[model samples]
Target: MYTQTEIIKDTTINGSEGELVINVGPQHPATHGVLHLVITLNGETIKKIEPHLGYIHRSIEKMCESLTYRQFIYVTSRMDYLSSHINNEACALCVEKGLQIEVPARAKVIRVLMGELTRIASHELWLGAMAMDLGAFTPFFYTFREREMINEIMEDTCGARLTMNYMVAGGVAMDLHPDFQRKVKLFVTQFKKRVPEFDDLITNNIIFQNRMKGVGVLSGEDAISYGCTGPVARGSGVSSDIRKLYPYDGYDAVAFDEVLETAGDSYARYLVRLREMHQSIRIIEQLIDAIPEGDFQAKTKAVLKLPKGEFYTRVETARGELGVYIVSEGGTTPYRIKFRSPGFSNLSALHHMAKGSKIGDLMATMGTLDLVIPDIDR
Candidate 1:
């Protein structure tokens, strides 16, 4: 086992010379994005893994500093496109906090609904990609079939499938579609039936279990130390769900479990995300029928400006905690902006988790981490 210190140093054993060095990707499909991993291997076992990033660096924080507050929130969508809704929500919440704007009840519930839907969609993609990483090609098709239902729902309401940019300072950009409820309810019913098929296809397969069970264990302490979040930290039994810790946008009213697993391995993380999709369904069901009738957006000034101060807001994205911090000089533009994206922190743990593991298991571990490289580069 490699300690955190040794892993950080990435020291090579002196006696073991002529070890193979390989670059996994800057364009590899298994990377999920333009992420390059330099792997040092001793035969089939991995000795070190170093991540080379910045292929898709957008400098989003600096760009947000120049744009007006309203324009800045949309930029975050490109960072974690999978959790774009939650990312937009986080930025909006921070801007609202600085301006001291109280969102309407209807908009709050709507935001929560959209946020949960984004979570399910992200997990669906992750489920498919993880299975494919393990060489189960059929599960990818199975998972994407269910995920497209979510894309359809988003397209009907948010007007965009990937980066909706539907959130604003006071609330969402528009009201839900006339058929939103009916469509979502139907999707919920259909997805519930198909969720089980994932287990039969990949989760319970003997080959998958062997590949995942004991590989790439991330202990609870190390998870926290490295600032891992979302399913990655939860799989290690770290109780850090931002929704439960700091409820916002009607999350306090909804009842849902913070999914947890104690094993701290790749399989544990995999199970956490799968169970979380059901919990997201649970959150949606609780709020769907009870959506209050009122304006979807609260009234705000045409030109919004924040008070001269610092403000921060956090939202639980599909990957994990997304924190938006803004320093305002009482202007339409932010003095400075910083996004604490989950992918960057989670990616930091790759070397620690991959060390001492076989080269083949590298894909399994990276799949469970579910990294989005743009989020890191930003």
Candidate 2:
């Protein structure tokens, strides 16, 4: 590892006595993905933490400036692959705003449904991975089983599972599959029936509580200042849900509670996501009943061209607020594109929470943070 002396310090946890510092990650599973942290500790208590990034930069932003608007949307899917649908929604909204087009009501409903499903899938993967990081492996399989079914649905409808570029500027790339409603209904029903068992299997277990509760606690005020959002911020009692702040599509019409927990620890984050899955399933239940009726795509010129101005759009992604900024010069290609990725913002809070914590707690903390590396690198 390359160390810059300017950013280095004798990190120590002072308890009116002594301290300790330990190196963690760059390879540790708990760090989530190539996240290296130089942690200062004092007998299992964290004192200071410094995170080193840029281990996976692909320069997706600079690359997007060269691609046409239509082609650029595909790159977003790679940013947060687990919640690619939400990333796709953000980019599509930006393009739609720039192009001055309206997505049909049906398209909006479908987009909402897809985005919620992606949220559920992302949470499920996190739940399983978090459990695994804490030394439980079986739950990973159970979570994967449920997530796999959702992926199959996405694959059948959007023709891709993880990187589903389902949304386009005007509307959806294609209509929902003929059996999308039935499939989603089945998944929702099964998920509702199976989700409760997760609580018994992990949340209520004595071991998990012993490992998590009160660990890496972040107060609501600190969470906001650190740029935490989605389940992480919600767990800290901060209501930073973009859906509530700015309803992009049919989110305003939906009836659902913004899940929140005041604990702001690893346990709180876990519980928030667990309940969030149920809420997402709830949203899907109401939408699946009526798929609505409309054209899958809107009419457009031979080549898509945005107005000579700047447009920005944000969406409540599973990670957090994902914003797409685009400046058009009345051309087929975007002059500049910037993605304010949620994971990047969420990752910023790691150092804040990691200071004065144990190395084991680092795993619990980072896993609860639910970071996706591509989103950070992008």
**What residue pairs clash in candidate 2, if any at all?**
46-356, 46-357, 47-356
- Clashing pairs for model 1 are none
Q: Model 2 segments beyond 4 Å from truth?
A: 1-21
User: What's the lDDT for candidate 1?
Assistant: 0.90
Compose the digit string of candidate 2's lDDT tens values, residues 259-323.
99999998998888888888888888888877678787778776788999999898898988888
Tell me each candidate's TM-score: 0.95, 0.93
Collision count for each candidate, in order: 0, 3
Q: What is residue 129's positional error in candidate 2, in angstroms? A: 0.1
Best candidate (score: TM-score): 1
TM-score of 2: 0.93
Scored by lDDT, the top model is 1
